[model samples]
Target chain A: MGTRAAGQVGRSGPVAWMALPALVFFLVFGVVPLFGVLVLSFTQWDGIGAINPAGLSNWRSVLSDPGLPHALWVTFEIMILSWLVQTPLSLLLGVFLAGRQRYRAFLAVLYFVPLLLSSAAIAITYKALLDPNFGLGAGLNIGFLTQDWLGKDNLALGVVIFVVSWQFIPFHSLIYQGGVRQIPTTMYEAASIDGAGRLRQFFSITVPQLKYTIITSSTLMVVGSLTFFDLIFVLTAGGPGDATRVLALDMYKRGFQANLMGPASVIAVLLVLIGLALALILRRLGGSTTASQQEGA
Target chain B: MAVATSAQATSRREAPGTSYGRKLLRLNWLGGTAGWLWLVIVIVPIYWIVITSFKDQSAFFAQNPFALPAEPTLANYQLVIESDFPRYFLNSVIITAGTIIPAVAIAFMAAYAIIRGAGSKFLAGVNGLFLMGLAIPLQATIIPVYLLIIKMHLYDSLLAIILPSIAFSIPLSVLVLTNFIRDVPKELFESMRVDGATEWGMLRSLALPLTRPALVTVSIYNGLGVWNGFLLPLILTQSPDKRPLPLALWTFQGQYSVNVPAVLASVVLTTLPIVVLYAIGRRQLLSGLTAGFSR
Candidate 1:
């Protein structure tokens, strides 16, 4: 036994070594930089400047700044709009595709096309389509249809939300579809014997069975909205008087554009905290609902 | 809404069901038709993009935006080729390949170690740190990363994007594959141990082979993300020659503002590679997406 225990100890050392390279890599890029930025949040420095000490000044300013609150509000607004649009639409589509239909497979592939293409590609395509000079308007010869979609502050955020929803609905739909597929056929048959109509069967069966899926998708959508950079950046560049400037974009503007590392780091820390907090909360919600979903059907 | 087909009508009668049966059947047809219509709305923009790419400048202005091209021309394609899109293509290919290979390899080995060392508190803590990675949005890290890269003199180089992309990617890769590895039967490890195989050898023989599907799934998924990645390249690199396709497309929109066909043509070219990958690995890419939550 002593010899076997010694042998296990010897083997464990090599097992630890396998993780060393990755551990070192993460330390350099992941953990170390994470803390480095946190420390940088407390100091005043541009990219190449000497680090000058600041006592809660960066945080103090960011907290009182109007941009922070407005950016936060817009970010949550996008999150709410996305959740409202994507969740139900995806649920309906998921159920429709999972039904015994002929074109289910083809439709699944088709719906997923937006996700396959890059956000850059999608944004540019839309930009051309919405261009007043030579876009859909000039081609269609309808003067009223020629409004500058991305240029108008009021319309740009909504347009961005619409485009983003188009790309992500399929993703959320797939989650709901996975959940729908897991519902046992026997349960449906049991409902059929009791004469539950399709709508009744759907409401009582499909929705409740998808509790965890809904929670998971909602978590992803919320966290994802907080980091809305690529599509909005490509579409509007936080455009037409900062209409679509999300917190993530604000972080970029402060850090890279303005060369204010201290305050930018503060935003970075907030993004990390907000994202992790929401995900953890929603994950717990998802976990608790799993039992109810399991007991549902 | 759609009228029920004769097939459904016949089936409903053959089943001898109540009126509720007819309603359900009608609902299915209605729902399915709505799904088809929504899909058509989604595909219309793609159709417009492809058709617009083939039109000449004057013909594009003359024609209806959604209409078919009057006389399709390859000149736009030629123009894009001559304008150095190929260089950007090469750069993107290099970055994607560079980032995915190392990220996946490092992540796979780390995942293996984590799974094997599950009893160790240190490994669990490491796993927690990786989860924390998903929370650190790239925008948050780009500032420090910019400074760090410049200090290392990797700024304005593809290595800048490659290194951070690899770093950000590892957390997800490790999290995903760790879940898969945890599901691998422990009895296999014990059997290999009985034969005196080292952990590395076991990883090579057992883990690599057993996790082939997950590995492939991971590769295509990460490859897509890296290929379509815009921010890192935009912030990190500077030279027009060093720019990737997304940045190339951005600059293309400006230079070819008058020649819209050339710009759309470039868009098509940039997206073509992704389309091909999607065609081949649609299932793998998609199932990989849901794999995280399902696990």
Candidate 2:
């Protein structure tokens, strides 16, 4: 028995040894850099010259900064608007296509086009489309819709949110469609035999089965929208009086544009904390739902 | 299941104008019509961009964007090509390919290790460590990364872009690959070990071949992410010669503000490769993303 146990240990030894390089890389590059950023958040540094030792000053400044509050509000606004618009639209589209296999393939391709294009390219195309004069925005006589899509305080953030939603709706649709496809046909047949309407069956069967996918997709959306920077950066550079400046954009401006490494690190650390909080919330929600599902089973 | 299949078969074999048949046909028609409408709506903006790229300067300015260009000309394409666009394309290709190969290979090894030792605490810690990459927003670290690049004398070089791209890709690649490897049955690995297969032999001969689908998905994901990346290239490479296509498009926008046709032409050229790639891998890519939902 001792020999057998020893053999088992020996068999597993090589596997653990093989994981060493990956562990070392993760430690030095991933964990250390993150810890470095957290440490730097407490110090004052201009990204050059000697780093002045400051204690909690950078964090205090970030907490009190007006831009932080404004950026947080815009971030949440964009996240909420994106989720609200994209989720329902994607579900409708997913359901619409679920019954038909032939043309669904074609429609899926079409919907995924925007996702293939680079954010820079998309921003440029939309910029041209939204050009206030002598562009698609003007030609369509929807100048109101086009009016400073990138430059206006009221419309810039909304436009960014719309663009993000448009790009990701297909992604959400794909998830929803996958979930919808997994529902056993017998349930639908039973519902129809009972004279239930399509909407009624949908609410009773479709949405409940899709709970996990919904949670997963929404988690992704929240994290993605919160950390969104590339599209907004290219589209407006957080213009029109910082109206569209989400937290990521604000962090970029602080660190890269303004070269305030210290405060930028603070914002970054905060963003990480926000992501962690959301993830924790999601875990709790996911765990309870899964437990309840198992209990029901 | 057999009864349902036979029922479906009988319905398929039924006459065209019967109640059930007509209902099915009508459902098909409704689905088809909505699908076509969605296709049209989604394709219009892309159509607009492509059409605008072909228009001459005057036609570009005078005509409606939704309408086709009158007297299509290749002058805009020619003009962009004659400029520094070629150099930017080369830079983009080099950086993307350079980053993807090493990142995928390293990630593959890491994923294999983690998968083979399912509940090992050290591997779990390593996995968690990689997840930290997801949280470190690029905006926060751009400053330090920039300083680090400059201090290392790698600024404005292809290395700057490649390093950060590869670094960021590790987490996602590791995530996807770990999931993929986890799905590989442990029996295969155990049999290989029983046969006295070396670790390298098992990875090269067994695991790598079985993970082809996952590899393809990961490659497409990595390719898209790297190819479309703009921020690192923007800050790291100031030399126009070193800039990639996205930055090149930005340059085109700035340089030829009045030459709108030329600007649109550059955008078309920049987006074409990725569009073609997506068209090829659309099914696999969508499946991969949805696969994440299942996990």
Best by lDDT: 1
Per-residue lDDT of B187 in model 1: 81
lDDT of 1 by residue, B1-295 (tens): 1134334444545444565597678768866776887798689888988999999998898888887887899999999999999999999999999999988998999899888876667777777778767655645667677778888999899999899888878877887788778778888988887888888899999999988778877888788788988888888889997898988888888788778888889889998998888898887766666666543
Worst 10 residues of 2 chain B by lDDT: B12-21
| Highest-scoring model, DockQ | 1
- Residue-level lDDT of model 1, residues A85-176, one tens digit each, is 88888888888777656578678888888887788888888888888888887789898768888889878888888898888888777777
i-RMSD of all predictions: 5.9, 6.1
Tens-digit per-residue lDDT, A33-81, candidate 2? 6677888888887765777778998889899999899999988888889
Model 1, position A208, has a per-residue lDDT of 82
Residue B169 of candidate 2: its Cα lDDT? 78
| Ten-residue stretch with the least lDDT total in model 2 chain A | A288-297
